[model samples]
Target: MNSLIEDVSPIAVDVYRSRRERVLAQLRAQGGGLAVLSTAPEVMRNRDTDYPFRHDSYFYYLTGFSEPEATLVLNASARDGEPASILFCREKNVERETWEGFRYGPEAAAEAFGFDAAFAIGALDDHMPRLLADQPALFYALGTSAELDAKVRGWIDAVRAQSRSGVRAPTRAQHLLPIIDEMRMVKDAHEIAIMRRAASISAEAHRGAMHACRPGMREYELEAELLYTFRRHGAQAPAYGSIVATGANACVLHYPAGNATMRDGDLVLIDAACELDGYASDITRTFPASGRFTPAQRELYDIVLAAQSAAIDATRAGVSFDALHQAALEVLSQGLLDTGILDKAKFGGVENVIAERAYARFYMHRTGHWLGMDVHDAGEYREADGPRDEQGARPWRTLVAGNVLTIEPGLYVRAAEDVPERYWNTGIRIEDDALVTPGGCELLTREVPVAADEIEALMRESISH
Candidate 1:
């Protein structure tokens, strides 16, 4: 392995090679074909500046190639009786290298990334036609990119042009997302190790935010604490934009403008996590800015904490994905009725409230989402069960070992005429990443305090020290 590549990525070379071999085996089972994958294109942030470049998930899954302007080609059925993994990448240019940084040209990329054959990206148009000829099928992310779609069409046309000269273009075209998505859904040992590290780093960052938060401070100030912790621990970036919502702002699910000043009596809700080695960890913690929750705030916070506990308990193998959501909903519905938030006479009862989904007014979003390479990671939530219903309800998939997901249960009480005045403007959510196991599940983000008293105590200790 090259020292440069080793220093950049913690993933071993054999791990990447093994991933390619597994994908090739799956392709062979599908009767063999040629699959093409490309990295994300660089985008302009402004007139002359460019946004940070991140490679496409699928391309990186197999090749681990991070450079822009690169494409991976996998030929499962090769004419030479050996499978071929080819890479097309930027060639070395002294002038470009002077301005930019070093590029692993064709030779270095092939050796470093475990590709059998390598070519300059400039030759893709000339080489793709020959590569496409005589293949039984063509596999690519159909409809993903207009440029790539046109390039594939042009390559097919080039192959068809040679039809009379004893060449044949692929008659079958298939979408490669489902095949790769399934492979990525189950985390291998290596992926789990990296994810554990990511979770640990993010957990400490959340703790830091809780400790650093103070009344009269801006939300972005707390956000800065989180960013510092992530980068200080070697995380690449936040999995998503950090949400630092205080008081009423927490009522908004995806609030990005975290500029409001926190009040002494307000509760701050932070939904933030970081990405390490391309694996993501998502965690959310809601705590009082004054280091102690008031009576009404503690009431709502305890309810949300209980609901999250129920959902986490249900995250186990053989359970359907919706089961966890249903468990959390039941707990939240009962809690709302127990409190004055939901009127028993108007909503009829806890059972009727759940049936009518009346709880959505206060807890609108789903309990949680799949977390992985992307925050809402790939794997489909629905599985084929007979004919689909008219309401378009797909059957939920059963959880399996190695599946990592978040259990987040929240309650947002905005100012409403019918809502209890005491509970208004109080939003609380407790989220933690859980890995399903045969026995039950393991909470990856458990190091951060979730209990109300524990959170208060931790904050107080930080201040006194």
Candidate 2:
């Protein structure tokens, strides 16, 4: 067992310690191995400067350590009785601290971050061989880090050198991500609390952006409003690039805020959110940049909103993962037919449009994705057992109580002779975070208005003053 300081983070130390214990149990179950994971390497933005540092999600999940150039080793070897959870990190340097920031060093890190033992990172090569000796397997993620792979090889090679002395290198290897990914998929009470705060902050930013938007403003000006709101409320940073698309710009799904000017009679689509602590919250809302949706714009906006509602209703524990997407798709496919986007005479009906995936012309992306640590998060979507469906592919897993996801359904209409001119260049998307529960799903980002009427009212009120 590792030593713990009660105040490691907003999350209790016991949670991380328990997670490490679970990994140990998994390792022991696999006949004793050394579980090794390293934090992300810091990348240089330019000469003598670096990009913002973020820890590797897997490493942070178990260690709760956020520093760069750090590694964790969990030894569960029966023969080599050794440290269960060990940390290797940077040693304290006052000169470096003055230029950079505080360094926990080894002794302080061991006590403060609750590791069984800690040492300067430079000593990993020297100590790894000893840890590798007599172990049955070495557990590390495959295709993750070349440096780690090289180090593991060197450690085993060092141990093999002493084989004549009865020292045995590991004969087996295993991937640690599968186990850790499953753990991250389910939200614990601590993670849920942090996510709720992130959602609230992001919701406020979306609401503010809608209020600040006007017909004459540049897209970047609206984006600045979002940044201001996120930081003003104490968010660390944007979870992803903020998309402040106006008019035809929204037709590009991944478009970031540009110099494009918002004009009257155009819809403004914003897909933005904040990362509070290490957790992330995501939300997207499309509204009229002029504080009023044109007749055609409101018609299409209502369709997208209704599709999102169907998807939200389909999200709950025991529902298959694809059920929600299919629910939204069915609604969207019908809407496309109703709007004649997919010519009703040529495409036949909703059944044929879905069968042909014809709705992709306007609504291309999936309804949503699992939302957590990374914006896309970490988790296997399909049943790991094997393919059981008639399509000969593995089926998506059923929704569980602890799961959280987004319900985003959108429409991007490009100009064409056959397409209606009024609907051309109109891109509308509505997104919200949903927490799956036994009874139903909770819409975490609803604090920002979703209904077309509510959005119009909020915008008109803000602009009136």
Candidate 3:
């Protein structure tokens, strides 16, 4: 490992501490138990080729350990004051290394990831029963891996066997989600730094796509440009599938069939976002295939931009998490009414339409979501009763300082005989990564040109020179 990469940032340490507190708190509440977590397994690309390995989201969130076929066990009753964080990993083999690549093995894994103890994966069955003996309950995401599930059940059954000796096994098994996800909801400085960098890089990619868009270019060609830009700027990978929809195709959300050739008089909507070291940045920008937007396109684009502005304003501290979507929906609904695209009566009243979900036909998806390690960063905004858990009286949790989310406001009009001619076949979305701060919201994507006139000006500047 490079010395530079090995020196984990203070933020990373902070994130680790936060995660530990969450897991330990749960373990203590349960009165001493063993919590087991596993990394994602590598899947095959073809007959023998294996796809590039990526750690499981929850596992990475807690341990920040990126290796494959590794399991983390937290022993709550360890003699040490602190709960034991143990990892079982592959042992280094010279022969295997010669054929494949470097393996972290047990020693390196423990030291690098700050685990209390480490052992070879081969010793799991032997170690598990002894460690889990008489524990109160088991903590793990069961059924995530069939093999792991079977192994865990077998180990628990062995513990159950002790009933004849008056040794009772744990009758409870708690899913690790509630505790882990709650920990992930709030971003520490370290996670925020990575996410900010990712947003900057993703913004650059969107800018590149904006400048590269021109008549006769295939949508996939433009997508290639955006992806190359992301990699060049050092994002780990695209947070989600890149959508390079041109003209009417933009109406199709999640459109990844990027084969359409851009035309002179069409709008190109590029919904491409990326993840940096796992922290995600999602952004959507719609621009004209030609350098400048047509009059109707500009009108609709401005409405979406205005809606996004409202959404950003709604992201202040102590504001409802859904306030932004409501604000943006108001702008969108008004714009549709002004453009005569929707019947105010048919859509169940403009303002009421949003509450009743009448605008879903065109909007299709939520205005935005929490952006972090996972694109739809793990954590629930609502409780089982579908109400805010805490944080204030807006019927939704208030936006806090460390919350980073996307403020994406879009309006898609599909081509149909009944649709107004002026608004036909136009899909417009303007998205920016907004960071909720103590004072207010800061637009992390301020660099990527977004003002209607600014986008056109940048396009002109790029092409004319």
How many clashes in each structure? 0, 0, 0
lDDT to native, each model: 0.89, 0.89, 0.81
Give the alpha carbon lDDT tens digit for every residue of 205-313 in model 3: 8888887777999999988988898899887788889999998999988889468899998999888878778788888888888888888888899999999988887
CA lDDT, candidate 2, residue 446: 92
Candidate 1: lDDT over CA atoms?
0.89
Residue lDDT tens for model 1, 115-229? 8989999998998898899999999999998998999999999999999999999999999888889888888888888889999999999999988989999999999999899
- Model 2 gets an lDDT of 0.89
Better of 1 and 2 by TM-score: 1
Off by over 4 Å in 3: 1-14, 81-83, 143-145, 344-349, 384-395
Clashing pairs in 3: none
Question: lDDT: which is higher, 2 or 3?
Answer: 2
Order candidates by lDDT, high to low: 1, 2, 3
> Would you give me the overall lDDT of model 3?
0.81
All candidates' TM-scores?
0.97, 0.96, 0.93
> How would you order the candidates by TM-score, starting with the best?
1, 2, 3
